[model samples]
Structures are given as C-alpha cells and as structure tokens.
Target: MSAESSGGQTPVEYIQHHLTNLSVGEGFWSLNIDTLFFSIGLAVLFGWIAKKVGDSLDPDNPKGMQNVLEVIVEFVDSQVKDSFQGRNPLIGPLALTIFVWIILMNAMDLIPVDLLPWLASLIGIHYLKVVPTTDLSATFGMSFSIFALIMFYNFKVKGPAGFAKMFLFHPFSANNVVVKIILMPFNILMTTIEEIAKPVSMGLRLFGNMFAGELIFILIAILPFWIQWIPGGIWAIFHVVVITLQAFIFMLLTIVYLSIAHQSQDDH
Candidate 1:
C-alpha cells in the first residue's frame, strides 16, 4: 500500500496507514485534511476550466478547446434536458458542475496510490489520502448538500401548507377523520424513513464503491512487482468505467430528486 520503507510494518499496518488521513484534531472535532485538500483543489480546477470555457466561448468560430468545452456543455445539457422537468435556470449549471466535479474527484483514483503519500512524507506530512470519494465524510457532505436543496425546492414549489400536507397524508390517507388520524403516524414514519434514506443511500453507495476500488488498488500494489501489472492494469481499466458511472449516477439521482421536489402533489 505504501512505497516507503516498510520498517518491519505488517501488510495490515501498511493498509491502515494508506487509509489514514492527515489531521490535526481529536475525536468529534477531527477533520480529514487530505479529503478536504484534494476535494477543494479539484473544485478549483473545475472552476478554472469552466471560467476558461466561458471566457473563450464563440458560437460562430468554435475550435480546439472551445469545441471540447462545447461538447462537454452539450453533453451535460442533454442530461439535464432528459432528467429535469419544469423551468429552472439553475438546474442545468448545477448538473454540469456536479457531473464534472464528481468525475474529477473519481478520476483521482487513477493516480499511483503510493505516489502522493510518499511525496508528502518527503515534505514532512505523515499521512495523505488523495481520493476524496473514498472518505465517508466527503461523500456524505455532498449528499447532504443535495438533500438540503431537495428540501428547499420542496418548500419553494409546494408552499408551507402543501408541504405539511404531503407528510401528513402521503402513502396512507382516509376520508374519515378518525381513520385519517389512525394512519397519520404510519404515514409520517414511512415518509420520514423515505426522506432520510435518500442522502444515506446516495452517500453510502458512492463511498462503498470508491472504497472497494481503492482497496483493490492497494491490494494490487502489494503484489510482487512483476505480477502486479496483470491485475492492476485490468482493475484500472475496469475502474475507469466505475468512476464515471458513479459520477453519472450521482448526477442523475440529484436531477431526479430535485425534479420530484419541484413537483406539487397535484402535479403528481
């Protein structure tokens, strides 16, 4: 897992070391510095590319970088057109940002596992994890943000009374007051579980897949030098699809949830 001198460290220790994050705090206040560092760095990279694209965009004379940027924009726009409903100017850009940013984060897995951490050690940093998606905090942070947006859109589109009505009457309802009262608790419970599950499932699914992929890469690195390429190369090729798919799935689900949130009960 590490290219550094093993110093009699066991394989388990090496893996744990690779998995560990460099941090400066303890317990509840601890931050995964590596995840924050890489995630923010990638976000800045995305922003820079987006700015360049915007500054240089020319519909009449598109070529080279402009053409490539236009293709990416069209691709994200098409995805937004397919999944999102209703007129929301923000959704298109939001979807594009999510897709490109997530793909970049996922793409960090392609880096040599030991390269960054070993380099960091040379500069006196002890631990570093380059793949942000592998960290639960990073994944959950993104999902939670999406969840907040869903909640906001729900309120904005439905109004207070309609939003409250959705929780009180959804999944089970009755005409009689007493019957409705009897079903209210069940409805609320089911609705709460359903709402909470969205972010949990989204965050966990991404984290689980990336963590497994990262572990496989680590395991591959542990193999004999000559034989490592066989499995490593194969998994690396397969993982390119996985990283892209996870990003697309995240973006698709975000658009779907937002679309659902933007719809009224009457519309449904």
Candidate 2:
C-alpha cells in the first residue's frame, strides 16, 4: 500500500516509531542500539579531547577547545575535591563521564524528533528512539551503574563490617541490646528503601523530563505546517536550556549521592 493509504500514518504510529529503540532482542532483553552507540561514542570523543587538553597544558597560553576543556576539568576537579574527602582515582573520571554522556544523550532531543525515525521508516525499520535519555532503560542503566559505584565506595571507606553495622543499627539504634535487636529489622527495611530510592529517583527524574519533552515535540509536529513552526521553534529553544540543565543536575545529584553514601557512620 502507498504510505498514506496505510491508515495515513496515524498519531499512534508516529509516536510508536519515535518511542521505539532500535534493539537486538525481544521484550526486556532488548537493547537500545542508538543509546549504546551514541553514549559510548560521545564518551570516547569527549574523554580524548579532555585528555589531550590536559596533557598539552601550556602555562604560557591557553586557547580554543583547550581553554574550554580546562575550565570544565578544573570545575569538576574542584567539586570532587570539595565534596569527596578521601582519595578516589575514579570519582573525577566518573563525574566527567556522567556529565558528557548525559549531555550527549540529552542533545539528541535537538535532532528534530521526526528526522531519524522518518529515515528509519523509509528503510522498513519502523521503530527508533533517537534520544537515549527518553528511554527509561538507558537512564536507569546509567543510574544503577552509579549506584554500584556508590556502594563500592561505601564499603571501601567503611569496611564491610562497618557498612553492615550502619544498616543494622543506624540512626535508630538503642543502648539496650534487646531494644536494638527489636529495631534491627526495621532499620534494615528503612535502609533498603533509602538505598533503592536513590537509583529509582535518579533514573526516573531524567527519564520523565526527557520523555515529556519528547512527547511535547511529537505533539507539536502533529500541528499544521504553518502553526507548527511557531510553538515548535519556541519549545526547541527552551528545551536546549532544559536538556543542558537536566544533564548538569543529574551529574550534581550523582556526586551528592556518592558523597552522602561515603560519609562515616559518626557523621550520619
């Protein structure tokens, strides 16, 4: 059938095409092809540039991309130093990774929501989500990775027994042994909930914002050509700021959560 004859490309089809990620498998096992490629590609590119800038540091003169990268590196270094007290070779790199990967994912929203999908449809592959942050799986995957890092640091800083004790007794401990025993389960439950909430909130927050933005863009694309440009242009401009701010916020929160998790029991 001709393109228009097949239900004239309904709104549902439009959205389904955009929301679908190019994947390798079925159901939950499905991978996000675009997200994986784009995130990794951007990480490598940004990392190489950052490293080159650092190695070629000129005390006498700094210009171009080197100058911009230096400011970013210095800012992130300062933040890591200010917040995380202990020695961690990983923290600075992890923060930079989060910042760059997320910003690149968010930047996909600027690529005209329909453009990539339209190209995909022409090739007989009907489903694709160009923006990785709009995919819950991608967002959660990143957040949970960060969560793993946080847990690692917690155990590394506190020791396994110390980390276990924090969860078992925690801020609700009692001096009496019997009372402490009674409250142990409750404390564990609370701690479990708190730990679980961190990754859930971190992932959902980014996913929700980007997904909502994508929906708005799709809705705008549905409007008449003449009127569509007005709202679409306005929202696109506003969304540039939104996407960047969200990336920065996600990075900041990741740092904050890691710092909190690494805190000593006495501090809590």
Candidate 1 residues 1-268, lDDT tens each?
Answer: 4333455567788789889988879987899999999999999988897789788788898888778767778988888899888889989888888888888999999998888987999999989999999999999999999999999988899999878877888888889999998988998898889988999999999999999999999888877677778898999999999998999899889999999999997774
TM-scores of all predicted structures:
0.95, 0.89
Clashing pairs in 1: none
Q: lDDT tens string, model 2, 1-268?
A: 2223334777777566567777898887887787787777777877788778778888789899877777777887887887776666877888877877787788888787667776777988667777878889888998999889888878877788889987899758899999999999999999988888899999999999999999888877777666778888999999988897888788888888888767886775
lDDT of 1: 0.88
Model 2 RMSD in angstroms: 2.9
Clashes in predicted model 2? 0
Candidate 2 runs further than 4 Å off: 1-7, 51-59
**Residue pairs in candidate 2 whose N, alpha carbon or C atoms collide under 3 angstroms:** none
Alpha-carbon local distance difference test for all models: 0.88, 0.81
Model 1's TM-score against the true structure: 0.95
